[model samples]
Target: MALVIEGEERISAPVDKVWAALNDPAVLKEAIPGCQKLEMKSPTEMAATVVLKIGPIKATFQGEVTLKNLNPPNGYTIEGEGKGGIAGFAKGGADVTLAADGDNATILKYAAKADVGGKIAQLGSRLIESTSKKLAGQFFSTFGEKVGG
Candidate 1:
């Protein structure tokens, strides 16, 4: 199954600050729901371990996340593909953009696309899509709050 989600939020910080925070491993770890570990492999790559639950199914996913289309204080694309053993596998990417709102605030926008396959897909396509959207919402809201404050 495939799904897409889009959203935006305002952060009460300057564009540079917001951009730095978004690229920070610790910040990403905290912003990503159920993210247990995030190890920066290089400037644009990270290894992540995350545990997610969808209704009665629970899975731990291991993945490599890469940042692309870099433009300082502007935006970038983040993409990852994770394996969940027998449960399934997921691959997704998000394009995020940042714009300065005056000199003290920034507006963040993103559009994400996700796809899944295997047992999880067969049983929970709808659930997965809804859950993905919910998680993205939660992540961005928390990200904005954390950066803004």
Candidate 2:
């Protein structure tokens, strides 16, 4: 199934700082919910391992993330795909944009689309969507704190 999600966050940090944080693996690893490992393979690519629980299922996913459309301190598109052995596979992409709220703050907006296949897909869209939404929220909340601090 396919899912789409969108939201905006007001971050208490400069747009440039927020953009730097977004590209930092150390910062991303802390912000990402259930992220066990996140390593940059190149300037635009990263490898990751994440553990997640969805309803009655739990799985560890190995994934790769790519950043596209360079627009320093402004925005870009992030795409990723993950495999979870027998549990399934997931793939998604999000377009993220950042605007300055002030010299010391920024507004971040994102629109995401995702898909799942295999056992996880059988669980239904509601569950998957909710879980994805929750994870995304957690990431931004933590990210805001980390960068804003």
Q: Count the backbone clashes (under 3 Å) in each candidate.
A: 0, 0
- Pairs of colliding residues, candidate 2: none
Model 1 TM-score, 2 decimals:
0.97
Model 1, C-alpha of 148: deviation from truth (Å): 0.8
Q: Per-residue lDDT of 42-143 in model 2, one digit per residue for the tens?
A: 999999999988888899999999999979989999999999999999999999999999689999999999999989999998999999999888888898
lDDT of 1 by residue, 1-149 (tens): 99999999999999999999989999989999999999999999999999988777799999999999999889999999999888889899999999999989999999999998877787666788889999999999999888898
Error of 2 at 134 (Å): 0.8
Candidate 2 worst ten-residue window by lDDT = 134-143
CA-lDDT, candidates in order: 0.92, 0.93
Clashing pairs in 1: none
Q: What value of lDDT does candidate 1 attain over all alpha carbons?
A: 0.92
